[model samples]
Target chain A: MFWSVTQSLLGGLLTTFQIFLFTLLFALPLGLILAFGSMTRFKPLRCLVQVLVWIIRGTPLMLQLIIIFYGPGLWLGHNIWSGNEAGRITATVVAFSINYACYFSVIFRGGIEGVPAGQREAGQVLGMTKSQIFFKVTLLQMVKRVVPPMSNEIITLVKDTSLARIIAAYELTFAGYSFMKSNGLTWPLFYTGVFYLLFVGILTLLFNHIERRLDYFR
Target chain B: MAILEVNDISKNFGSTTVLHKVSFSLEEGSALAIIGSSGSGKTTLLRCLNFLERPDNGSIVVRGETLFDASMPFKEQEKGLRTKRLHFGMVFQSFNLFPQYTALENVTLAEGLLAKEREDYKQNKKTICEQIEKHGRELLDQMGLADRMTHYPHQLSGGQQQRVAIARALALKPDILCFDEPTSALDPELTGEVLKVIRGLAEQRTTMIIVTHEMAFARDVSDKLIFMDDGVIVEQGDPKQVIDHPREERTRQFLTRYAQG
Candidate 1:
């Protein structure tokens, strides 16, 4: 009985990990693009991106997941996502990526702007083109500045993955809760906390390693 | 021939004019020092020459080539602006080295990036990079930072950072190098080291335009000096002459204030 329960929770953990990985894969680059959009010199485009980011950030992630997963079926009279486990997971990932991307974009913008203006002026006087200056001078310094805040958001992302259970995506938390629903066993729910702890632990170690690598500068 | 010729460059922010019809010419292989009280537009003048700030009305002619003209269309003036900026190397009051890169990398980063534009960069990539590294090492050695080539900016002293900045500016072998109060940010002891580097460059006949408060150093190093007051040149001639005997009341008052301070 114990082995079977552990095996079941492991399957759920896999789904949780999948959601976490895919959200980052999509959101990291998306966040940088959004950051540039919000910072663009073109006023209209900047305003448009800022407004969109504001809306995404203002709403709750759980509400976004519900709307993305079920709203189309209710409002459009047709479900865009198929009635399957894969479809639910896909909807959950989409909502999570968009939500986290907005948060990350704000962090990225802060990091980029934190670099001293004199640094860019130095690049300009060195004969570097604007793009060259951004990539070589500004971008590297930005990465250093963003790491601490970025690590905070990423850890928060790990815990927020549990929100996917709201869409019936059988993630780790749901797997744990299912034991209480079926067998009237609550110990598995406690067991599921171990998986999240381990995941967050590994992430903490990885971020520490990255911070150490970047410590050569300042 | 004059290496740089500026005619009636003017700049205004909103309604207040920062510089009004500032004009000057720099001879080849000579150093010109600009000294003035704060807000006298000395830094702004240097910025206009390097294209960091646009002049509202004027022309900048370098090597007899018109680089900037107020009469030109905005788009036309912006065209080739980056390459034109290569004519003047700038060293800031703050030694604005890229903190992430090593001292040597800070010196070579620009040259390495510019090297990619060469048509032969692909076939000669290894050799070109080796040459760049060699030149970078030599420059660091010249800056007395041979052992600090691999040290990040945070690991170096202010004087060392400024020397690296000077080396970085010189890597492109600019026709004219501009220093905007290069030692203003350093302590008195550190100031001597940076000044020594500039003194060596001056002795080598490096054409330079310096904006500085080091009146004695300015007199010793610069061939010509300009005293600016209220966004205009108050008096300019030999550095020693301007320092010893000023013709304008504003220049004399400013010099006396600086002396007492």
Candidate 2:
């Protein structure tokens, strides 16, 4: 029975990992784009992006997931998403990416701004074009600055994937919870905690390695 | 012919005028030093020469070409600002080297980026890169940083960082190199090394414009000196004459205060 429970939870962990990976793949670049949008010199675009980020960050991720998964069918009077496991997973990933991208953008903006203005001026006087300065000088420094805060958000993201269970997505937590409903067993729920700890432990090691590599400078 | 000419440059930030019709000219292979109290606009003038700051009303001409003209729209002036900036290399007081890059990478980065634009870059990539690396190393060696090329900025002393910055600036072979109080951030002990490098550059007839408070070094190393007060050049001429015999009351007052301080 213990072995069976472990196997079932492993299946759900796969789904959990997919959500985590897909969210990052979409959110990382989106966060940088949003960061640029928030920092744009043009007042209108900056204001618009700031408002969008504010709205996304002000609300709860769980609420966002529910609304995105169900709102399209409710408001439009037709289900835009197909009623299948893939559809539910897609909605969850979309909600998670948008939610995390906003948080990541704030971190990115802080990192970018924290680099001294003199660095950019040095690039300018070296005859570098603006984009060249951004990529070569500003971006590399920003990666160093953003790493600690970004690691925090990424670890938080790992735990937050459990929120997908709310919309009946059969992720790790849901798999652990299902045994209690069917077999009247609660130990598997405790087992799920171990999986999360191991996942977070691996992430901690990876972040430590990255932070060490970046230590070559600061 | 003057290698650089600044004709009536003025800059205003909102209602406060920072530079008031400042004018000066720099001859090729001659070093000019600008000495002033803080807020006297000496740094702004150097920045204007490097196109780091746009003058509200004036023109900057280098090598008989008008690089910036206030009569042109700001958009038009910006169009070629990057290329125009190549005419002058700048070193900041903070030694603003990219911390992530080693001294050698910092020195070669700009040249390597510019080389990518050459039509023959694809066919001659290896040779071009090797040439850039060789030049970068030579400049670093000239700055007395021969053994420290692989060290990151944070690993170097303030004086060493400034030397790397000088080497980085020289990597581009700019017509005029500008320094904005390059030694101001260094310790008194460290200032000598940086000054020695600048003095060597002067001896080699590398054209330079320096904004500094090192009055004695300015007097010895510069061909011409300018004394600025309240956004204008109060006195300028032979460095020895300007430092030893001031022609303006403000210049005298500033010198006396500097001497006392």
Candidate 3:
């Protein structure tokens, strides 16, 4: 009776939150680089990146999870992902990073290419160097353009972290379900929904505020 | 001696020969207009001066530095060409103002980049800001965009955006400024606004090379006018001669078609 729901759920929520932060850390910069590479003028380089993004986007995420978790040992005959919670978390991170990065790159590329070629020429006319043009001019506008779509992916990410359970990672969903099976506390699994809702709600409101700020673009 | 020297600059886009045996020069702080029908290689020649398009065969000497000297070889001359371009600024038919930035950021970003490379790199940020604000405020104000400083390009009117474009080019304080049909995108009403700004800049003795079809505008503003046709300079001289007393038959035909009463 003393096993209160708040404490039990809080532990699982902590794990869920960690995955969200870590995924963003690795994915944002990686996605931008991939976007730039895909837009490269060099034909072979563009083709290579396009094929990679296509395969990453076309395949199912769950399949990616299974492969990322299990493929290394089978393919290389070495268990690079050690047998522990660390390995499970590592595998989940890799799978999540790759899947989200591919999605993020498309948003990034669209934002950048949407910037008019005229703007770049204008920057050159002002004597801005290539890097200055990108960071100061192109990238700033790109962020505004990409935000709404990026927010969509981010909110989806809040839900996607639950997918980590497939690899036997003791993330929020796993912890909640464990209560259901062992103690027959079905309430805990349903309780997990509250955690997800709060996260998504907060992120959605944050994005809405950003959109309001960018309303000046109107 | 001419402050600028160009010898045999030629360019082709893949198979289409856009410019052939094109060459020109200018005196320091002199206003020269390159007037031509569309696709007559006028814009491309101006682009060569700015390194926006590398010429296939030519040598352009600005001040004393050789820019785009393809005669020496491509690889050896690329760096020198890019360096020379830092001394000149250009505006295009389209305003090309960065849609994401405010008017001030657009100007400051350029100075921050190109100025840092000069010997006076470690100068005070306050002075830099003062210079930018002084020129940027005056230009945008003169172009009638003082109220729209923080506005994005999309938020501004077409005429206002072109004013921002002019402000950006002037911010660089380059040795010369080039305009490629700068008013073509504007409505007749809006065209007057941008042209008026250019006229004011020209009155201040701002060195300029303009490519335009506005015959009166070109004739009135140009110290020298060049009529380029079929990728060659058909005629050029004082504006009164080229615009009024044309020497070449082609120049007369061109001027007559658009000559205003």
Candidate 4:
């Protein structure tokens, strides 16, 4: 029975890991684009992006997941995300990507702006085009500056993956909770913490390695 | 013909005028050193030539290419200004080297981009990379940073960083170079190292315009000198004549202050 529970929880952990990876894969680059939009010289676009980010960040991710999962079916009378495991996971990923992207964008904007204006001027005077300056000089320095904050958010995201259980996504937490409900067992539920701890522990090590590599900027 | 010409350039910030009808001409392979007190608009004049700061009214003609003309719509001038910026390299008071790039990468980054701008270079990636590496190394070697090329800006001393910045500027092979008090941010001991490099460039007769308070170096290295006070040129002539015998009272006062201080 214990072996079976372990096997079942591992299956759930796989789903959780999928959610975590997909969220980061979509959010990281989307956040950077939003960051540029937020700081763009074009007044209307900047304000529009800022407002959209404000709304996403102001609301709870759990609420966002519920709305995203059901809003299309309820409001439009069309079940875009059908009652299937893949559809549920897709909705969770979408809601999480949008939510985390807003937070990451704020960090990215701070990091980009934190680089001294003189550095851009230096690139310009050396005959670099604006895009070249942004990618070559500004972007790398911004990455170095943003890593610590970005790592913090990513760790929080790993734990937040449990929230996907609200949409019946069958992630690690849902698998653990099912055992308690069906078999009157609590230990397996507690075992879920181990999985999260291990995941976050490995992430911490990875981020530390990244920080060391970026240390040359300081 | 003059390598650079600034004709009646004027700038105003809000209501107060910062540069008033500033005019100057620089010959090829010559250095013009501008000296002045604080708020004298010397730096503004230098920045205007590179289009870093737009002059409200004037024309900047570099290598016979009209970079900025007040009559042209500001929007249309951006492309020309950017393309022409290749001909006017500038070194800032603070060594603004990209902190993430090593000295060698800092020197090569612009060269690689400028190369890629050409359609033929896009098809010859290996050849372009090799060419940029060779050119970058030569500039760093000239700046006496041969061994320091792999070091990041933060790892190097201020003097070394400034030298790397100079190499980064020179990698473009600009028609003229401009320095905005390049040694001002360095320690007294560090100042000599940067000034020595500038002196070397002067010996090679690189066309340059320097806004500086280093009266002694200005007299020693610059072919022409201009003393600016209160948004206008109070005096300008051969460096020795301007330094030794100032025609304007403002220039005399400024020189006396520098000499005593």
Candidate 5:
């Protein structure tokens, strides 16, 4: 009986992992582009990006998931996401990507701007173009500066994947909660915590390793 | 003909003029040292040559090509100025080596970019890389940093970082090299290491313009020296003549303090 319960949780963990992986793959680069947009000298672009980031960051992720999943269908008189399991998962991923991208953009903008202007000027005097200066001299230092904060957000994201349960997307927590209602097995609901703890523990190790690799800056 | 020429170049930051019609010329292999009190426009003049600080008026001619003309639109001049800057290498007071790059990488990164700009380099990419690597190693070796080639900037001393910066600048083989208070950031003992490398370059007759406070070193190393005060050149001529026999009251007052020290 215990074996079956563990097996079911592991299956749900796969979906959780999928959401986590896809969100990062999309969000990291999207965040960098948004960061550049926010820092542009062009006035309209800079203001538009800042306002968009502000709205996405101000709202709760769970509320965003609900609205993103159901709002389009209700407003347009058609189920844009098709009212299926795939549709529910797609909505969850879209909401997570948009939400995390905004947060990561703030972290990235801070990192990029925090680098000293002298470094960029040095690249300039070396006859490097502006883009070359950014990629060659500034990008590595920016990454080093942003890592600690970025890791905090990433670890939080692992736990927040359980919020996918709000939309009835079958992630790890949703699977565990279902066990409590059907078989009255409260153990699985608590057992889900172990999986989250293990995931976070591994992520902590990974981030620590990254920090060491970037230790040359100091 | 001179290797580099700045004709009546003037720079203004807001309403205040910093460099007022500053005109100077550098011979092919002569070293020119610019001396001045703080905020005397010494550093600003150096920056203007590299186009780091654009001059509001006057023209800059490098190797017979006019890079900047006050009469021209900035958009047209900026595109030309960037390409012209390749002929001049600038060393800063802060030793702005890319912190993430190793000593060798810092020296070679710009070399690779410069090579990419050459149409010939496209057909000979392997040869270009090999040449860059060989020349970069030679420059570091010349700076006495061969063993520390792989070391990052943070691991090096202020002197060592400045020396690496010198090697990086030299890797491009610029027609003229400009130094802006290169030893100001170093300790007294550390300053010697950087000064020694510069002395070697001077001995080899590398064309250089150094803005410095090392009065004795400037007297010994420079062929031509200019003393600047309050946005204008107060005195200029042979380094020893200007240092020993000042013609202007401001230049005499400035040199006496160095003499007393």
Candidate 6:
């Protein structure tokens, strides 16, 4: 039973890992750009971005995942993300990116804004251009400030990917539950906790190391 | 030509004017100490130099270049302001070092920015470490903060933080360095360490403008002094002439109230 559970869980683990990496690959950069949008000095752009963030953050992750994956087809009347493994993955990515992007945006906004206004002024006086000031002084500091909260979100994401099973994507947790349905083996369902525990443990260690490296900014 | 000139520069927040038709000029490489009571607009005048606060009237010319003009909007003058900012460095009372960055990162940021602007300016990225180490080391060494280079702002004392701020400002080798009440945040004992550092910079002939309340330090280090009151320069002259022997009654009264008791 344990052997069969391990095999099914491993397949689920593979799918889970891909979603996690792909989401971060797209989500991190998209979050930074959204952060800039929310921070834009132009009132219209800032207002528009803020409203979007309010919508995403104000809603539940479960509702968003269901709506984004299923809503597009119903609203567009095209069945765009059809029923298949690849299609499910695509929908999951879209939903996950939007939800995480909003969370990441708040973190990014706080980090960038938290950097003192004087540092940028000092940069300007030193003859650095606006872009230079951001990349050098502003962004460097923003990264350090954002890391703690960002790590929290990233670790949360490791668990959040399991939510993809809601749309029948066959992720780790789904694989564990499959054994109970097929052969009435509840142990396999409980064993899913191991996969989650290990992933979260690894992420905790990485974040701790990064915090140590930033000790200079204390 | 004066190295820097402020021609009738004024600024208002909403309807209340903080600076009004204020005009002044200073020579290259001179220490001009601006003294004033709270809300007297000393810092506002200094910020206008860097275009951090856009003036509502008139213009500021740096080294004979018209960086700001009320005739043009701030967006139109932004390029000139950008160019002008390259000519000076500002240190804040709060020691606004990028809190996430170490002292070394703060210093190299200036050099990196300049290198990026000059496109063909291929900097050997590998040597950047050595340069930061050398220059960052030297500036900190000069400010007596060599051991604290890797330390963060919150980790350092108020005086030490201000010293790092001064080091960060000088790292760019700017044509002018401005300080806004740099020692106000420090204790009296720590204040002297920062003042000593500034006096050393003055001795090195680094062009600077200091808005401060330390009357004795201002008198000792300033080559020229301007007393600002209610958004106007009420008095101006050599430190000895203006601070020691005031021509205006208000300046005299203000100095007597704050001067060493």
Q: B177, model 6: CA deviation in Å?
A: 2.5
The ten-residue window of minimal lDDT in model 5 chain B covers: B74-83
Better of 1 and 5 by TM-score: 1
Q: Put down candidate 2 lDDT per residue, B105-168, tens digits, no spaces.
A: 9999999999999999999999999999999999999999999999999999999999999999
lDDT for predicted candidate 3 compared with the true structure:
0.81
Candidate 2's C-alpha runs over 4 A off are: none
lDDT of 5 by residue, A16-93 (tens): 998899899889999999999999999999999999998999899999999999899889988888678778878888
CAPRI grade of model 6: medium
lDDT of 4 by residue, B103-184 (tens): 9998898888878878888689899899899999999999889999899888999999999989988988899999999999
- Candidate 2, fnat value? 0.98
RMSD of each: 1.1, 0.9, 2.8, 1.6, 1.8, 2.7
Runs in model 3 lying further than 4 Å from the true structure = A1-3, A42-44, A75-78, A183-189, B80-82, B118-123, B138-156, B259-261
- Candidate 5 lDDT, B20-125, residue by residue in tens: 9898898999999999999999999988888788898999887898888888887888775556787889999999989888999999999898789888987999
lDDT of 1 by residue, B204-256 (tens): 99999999999999999999999998889889899998999888888899999
lDDT for each residue of candidate 4 in A63-103, tens digit (9 for 90 to 100): 99999999999999998997998899889999999999999
Error of 6 at B29 (Å): 3.3
What's the CA error at residue B206 for candidate 3, in Å? 2.4
| Per-candidate interface DockQ score | 0.86, 0.91, 0.48, 0.74, 0.67, 0.55
Best by TM-score: 2
How many clashes in each candidate? 0, 0, 0, 0, 0, 1
Provide the TM-score for each candidate, comma-separated. Answer: 0.98, 0.99, 0.90, 0.96, 0.95, 0.91
Model 1 bad stretches (over 4 Å): none
Chain B of candidate 6 achieves a TM-score of: 0.94
What digit string (tens of lDDT, one per residue) describes model 3 on residues A1-218? 32666676777777778888888899898899889889889989899889989998899888899999899889999978998977887788888888888899999999999988877766665656788779877887898899999999999888888888898877888878888788888877767787788889999899999888877763
Summarize candidate 1's per-residue lDDT along A146-187 as a digit string, tens digits: 999999999999889889888899889999999999999989
State the displacement of the C-alpha of residue A136, model 2, in Å, after optimal TM-score superposition. 1.2
Model 5, residue B33: C-alpha shift (Å)? 0.9
